[model samples]
Target: MQISIIHEREVWDRFIDQSPGGTIFHKWDFLKTVEKHLGYKLLPYGFYVTDEILCAIPLFYKNIRGVKMLFSPPPQSGIPYLGFVLSRNCMNMKLSKKSQRMYEMGKVFSDEVDSLSPNYVSISLTPFITDVRPFKWNGFMIDPLYTFYFDLEQSLEDICNGFNTSKRTAVKKMDKYNMKLVESKDVKQFYNSSVDRYREQGLTFPIVSIAYLEELCQLYPCHIKVYSIMDADDNMVGGVLASEHRKVTMWIGSVKPSVKAPVNEFLFWEFIKKSKSEGYQELEMGGADVPRLCAFKSQFNPDMYVNYRIYKKDLIGSMAEWFYLNVHRKKKA
Candidate 1:
C-alpha cells in the first residue's frame, strides 16, 4: 500500500460519504470553510493500494509562535471527531482480515503524517474506530475523552423515562416561564451568550469567530440550526446552535446567567423533539470534560462514548507544550 496527498475534491468527499466513520467535519466543504475562516493550511492525505483508496485523513497545518503543528479537524473550530475515514469495504471483510487491513492502513497513515515533519501532530479520532493499537504502536500518545449521545430510535416516552428526575422536573417547570423557542439566522446572540457564560465562570471563551459561525450557517443552512429561547417579555434567555450529519446532531448551547428558569433544559428538549420529528437517529450532546458540564448533561441519561486524542511530538514540540502548560496557562490562571 502507498500513501499520497489527495487533491481532488470529488474523490475525497466520495470516500467520506461512503465511510460509516465519516462525520460532517470530514466533508470537503466544512474543512474548506474552516481553512478559509480560521486560516489553517489544509493537507488532506489518502492511503491507497495501487489506484484504490483505502482510507483518508484530513489535516490542517498551522505555525503557532513559529512552531509548526498539524491538527486533524483543527482546534477551536467546533469540530469534535476527525481522525480517519476508512473505506466501507472493510465491513465486508472477516474480523481477522479487517484488523490486518486497519493495521496496515494505520502504518501508512502514520508514515504519511510523519513525512510532513510538523513539530507537533494531534488528532481526535471518532468513536467508531475502537482499535488504536496500530497508532499506539506508531508512538502516538493517547488520551481518552468522552461525549454523551442519545439514541433517538427509542420511543420519546421511553427516552424521557431514562432522564433523571431533576431533568424531567426542569422540563415540566418550563411551562410556568412562558418560554418560546424561535429559530433564527443570527449567530451573534448565541456567541455573545456563550462568551457571557464563560466570563461568569472566569474562563476564556474558546469558540471560533462569529463571522465563521455566520459563514458556516450560511454555507450549510440545511445542516445547521440556530434557535433562541425567549421569555414572555421577549428577552433572549438562552440559545443553541447545532449541526446535523448522517442522522446525528452535535450541539453548542448557552443560557443567560441572570435568568433563573430552566431555559437550557427546555431548549434541549425542544431540539431533541424536532430532531426526532425530522428523522434523525441520534443526538450527540458534545463532550463532557468539565465536571460541572458532565453533571449537567448526565441528567438527560445519554450514553457515554470515549474519544481518543492521539499526539506525536518532536523535541521542539515538547518545549512548546511545556511552555504553554506551565508559563502561558499559569499566566491565564
Candidate 2:
C-alpha cells in the first residue's frame, strides 16, 4: 500500500461520501475551514493498493515552537471525530478478510504518519471504524470516548417516548409561550451566545472568530442550518446549529434563555422532528462527556456509541499536551 497526500478536493470529498464512517468534518471544505480559522495546515491522506483507494484520513499538521504535531479533528475544535474511513468494498469484506485488510491499512498508515516525524500525534476515529488494535500495536495509547445517538428510524412518537418526564414537559411547554422557530443566517448571534455560554461555565468556545462561523454557513448553505427560537414579540432567545447528512448532528445549542422557558429542549424537539422529517437515519447529539452535559443529554435517553482517541508523545510532546490543557486553554480557544 502507498500513502500519499491527496490535494484534489473532489477526489477526497467523493471518497468521504463513499465511506460509512465519514462525516462532513472529513470533507474537503470543512478541513479547509478549520485550517483557515485555526491556522493549522491540513493534510488529506489517501491509502491505496495499486490503483485502487482503500481508505483515507485527514491530519492537521502544526508546529509549536520547535515540536511538530499531527492531529485528526484536533482538540477543542468541537469536531467529534475525524480519522480514517474505509472504502465500501473494504467495509463489506468478510470478517477475517476485513480484519486483515484493516491491519494492513493501519500498518501502512501508521508507518507513513511516523515518516512524517511529528513529535506528537493524535487521532479520533468515528464509531463506525472500531478497529484500533493496529494503532495500539504501533505504540499509540488508545482511550475510549462516547457520544449520544438517537436512531431516527422510529416514529417521532416512539422517539419521544424515551425522553424523561421533565424533558417531555419542556417539549410540550413551548406552545404555551407562542414561541416559533425560524431558520436564519445569523451565525454571528449564534456564535456570541455560544461564547457567552462557554464563558459562563468557565470553558472557552473553541473557534474564536465569528468569521469561521460565517464561512461555514457560506460554504454549506444547505447542509448546515441555524434555527432560532423567537418569542411572541419576535425576540431571538435560543437556537441550535446543526449539520445534515446521512446522520444529522447537533453541533451547537444556544444558552438557556434569560426568562424561564424550555429553550434548549424546544430547539432539540423541533430539530429532531425536522431531521426525522427529512429522512435521516440517525441523529448524533455528541458532547455529553462533560458531567453537566451528560446529565442533560441523558434525559433524552439517547443510546451511547464508542469512539477512540489515539495518541503518542515524546517527552516534549507530552509536556506540550500538558501545558495545552493546563495553561494555554485558559487563555485562548
Candidate 3:
C-alpha cells in the first residue's frame, strides 16, 4: 500500500458517504471550511494499493511558533470527530481481509504521519471506526471520549417512550405554547445565540467564527438546517441547527432561550420526530463528556459510543499543550 495526496473532490466526498464513519464534516468542502477558518493547510492523504484507494485521512497541519502540529478537526472547532475514513471497498471486505487491511492501513497512515515529523498531533476518530489498536501499536496514546446516538428506526411513539418523564412533560408543556418547529435559513440568529449562550455561561463558544458556520451551510444547504421553534407571536423562541447526513445531528442552536421553558428538550423531541419523518434512522446526539450535558442527554436514553482522541507530542509540544490548556484557554475563559 502507498500513501498519496488525493486531489479528486467528488470522488472523495462519495467515498465519505459510503464509509460507515463518514459525516458531512468529512466532506471536502468542510475540510476547506476548516482550513479557511482555522488557517491550517489540509493534507488530504489517501492510502492506496495500486489504483484502488482503501482509506484516507483528512489531516490538517500547521507550524506555530516553531512547533509543527497536526489535527483532524482542529480543537475548539466545534467538530466532535474527524479522522481517517475507510473506503466502501475496504468496509465491505470479508472479516479476514478487512482485519489485515485495517492493520496495514493503520501502519501506513502512522508511518506517513510520522514522516511529517510533527511536534504534536491530535486525532479524534468518529465512533463508527470501532478500533484503535492499529494506531495504538504505532506509538500513540488514546483518550476515550464519548457521544450518544438515539436510534430513530423505531416508531415515533416508541422512540418517545425512551424519554424520561420530565422530558416527556417538558415536550407536552412546550406543545401547549403552540410553538412550531420549522426549518429556516436564519443562521446568523442561531450563531449569535450560540455565542451569547456561551458568554452567559462564562465560557468560550467552540465555533471559530460565524463565517465558518455560514460557509458550511451555504456549501451544503440540503445537509444543514436551522430548525427553529417559533411562538404564536412569530418569535423564535428556541431552536437547534441540525445537520442531515447519514444521521440527523443536533449540531448547534440548543442555547439560551428567551422564554422560561425547556426549549432544548422541546427542540430535541421535535428534531427527532422531524428526522424520523424524513426517513433518517439514526441521530448523532453529539458529545456526552460534560457532566451537565450528560444529565440532559441521558434523558433520551440514547446508546453510548466511545471515540478515541489519539495523540503524540514531544517535550516542546507537551509544554505548548499544557500552556494552551492551563493558561491560554483559561485566560480566554
Candidate 4:
C-alpha cells in the first residue's frame, strides 16, 4: 500500500478521529491549537494506508545538531515525562503473527519518523498497557513512569465498593463536611489561591504559570477546564485544573486550609463524575509523588501502574540535558 504525507488539516483530523486509539490530544484541532498557542514545532504527520488508514503518527519535523528528525512536540524540554501525543486506536493495535497488515501500519509511520533525520522521536501514552506497544516497536526508547487512573464506567456504588476502608472513610468525611464542587471559568482566584496554598504548606509546585493555563484554555477551549469546590460561605476550599485527552481526563488538585473539608476527595469525585457525564471513560490522576500520591489516589479504586519514559540520546545532547537537570536539581537542594 502507498503511504502519503498528509498536510491538509481536514485530512489529518479525519484519520485521527477514526484511528484505533484516537484521543483528543492527537486531534488535529488540539495539536494545531497547542502549536498555535505554545509555538512549539510539531512533526510532519502522514497516514499509513493499505486497505484503509490503519494508523498515523502525528509528528513535527525538527533539526537538532545538523540532523533532522520527526517527533511530537513542546513538552517542557527538561521534563522526563513529555512526548508526542497519539490516538488510542493506533496505540492498541496488537502485535500478533497473523497481524501483518496491522504491523505494517506502525512500520510505515516508524519509517517516516526515522526518515525525519533527527536523533530521536518521543511519544507519550496513557497508563494502560493496551495503549503502549505501538511506540515500543519503532525503536523509540521506553521509560515506564508510574501513573494512576480511575475507570468511571462503573456505577458510583461499584466504584465505592472497590475502595479500601481508609479511602472509604475519606470519602465519607468529605461528604459529611458539606463541601460541594463548583465549575467556573474564574482563573485568577483559583491560580492565586493554589500558588499561595502551595507556599503556605512549604511545598514546591511543578506546574506551569497561570499565563500558560490561560494560553491553554484559549487554545483548546473545550478540552482544558477548571473546576473548584467552595464552602457554604462561597470561599474556595479546593480546586483542580484538568485537560481532556481522548477518552481520558486527568486533573491537578489543591486545597485551602480554612475549609476544614475533604476538598481533595470531593474534587476527585467531581472530576470523575464530570468526566463520565461528558462521555469520557477514564479519569487520570496523572503521576503521583510515589507512595504518597499513589496511596491518596488508591481511594478512587484506580488501576495503578508505572508509566515508563524511554530515553536515548546520541551521547552529546543526552549529556547536556542530563547536566542541565542535575544543575537545577542541585540548586534546588
Total clashing pairs for each candidate: 0, 0, 0, 29
Query: How good is model 3 by TM-score?
Result: 0.95
Sliding window of 10 residues with minimal summed lDDT for model 4: 76-85
Per-residue error for 162 in candidate 4, Å, reads 2.4
User: lDDT of candidate 4 vs native?
Assistant: 0.59
Query: What are the per-residue Cα lDDT tens digits for candidate 3 across 1-333?
Result: 899998989878878877786888899988988998999999988888998878888999999989899999797678888888888778788988988998888888888888999999999988768778888888889999998887888887887788899877776677577778888888888788777777778777788888888888899999977778888888887767688987888887576676786777877788787778889988887759988788878998888888899999999899989989899877776
Cα-based RMSD of the predictions, in order?
2.0, 1.6, 1.6, 4.4
lDDT of 2 by residue, 1-333 (tens): 788989899998899898887888887998999998887899898889887888998999999799899999876566778898889989899999988888888788778878888989989889988889888887889989999888888888887888999998777676888888899888988888878877877778876478877888899888888888898899888877888866788886655566687777887788788888888888888866767778888999988898899988999998998898889998764
Winner of 1 and 4 under TM-score: 1
* Candidate 4: residue 147 lDDT (0-100): 67
Error of 2 at 214 (Å): 1.1
Error of 2 at 237 (Å): 1.6
Comparing 1 with 3 on TM-score, the higher-scoring candidate is: 3
- Clash pairs, model 1 backbone: none
Q: Which residues of candidate 1, in runs, are more than 4 Å off? A: 325-333
Error of 1 at 234 (Å): 2.0
- Give TM per candidate: 0.93, 0.95, 0.95, 0.76
Model 4 segments beyond 4 Å from truth? 1-5, 50-52, 60-73, 77-98, 101-111, 126-138, 195-209, 244-248, 254-260, 274-280, 305-311, 328-333
After superposition, candidate 2 runs with Cα above 4 Å error: none
Clashes of 2: 0
Q: Candidate 2 clashing pairs?
A: none
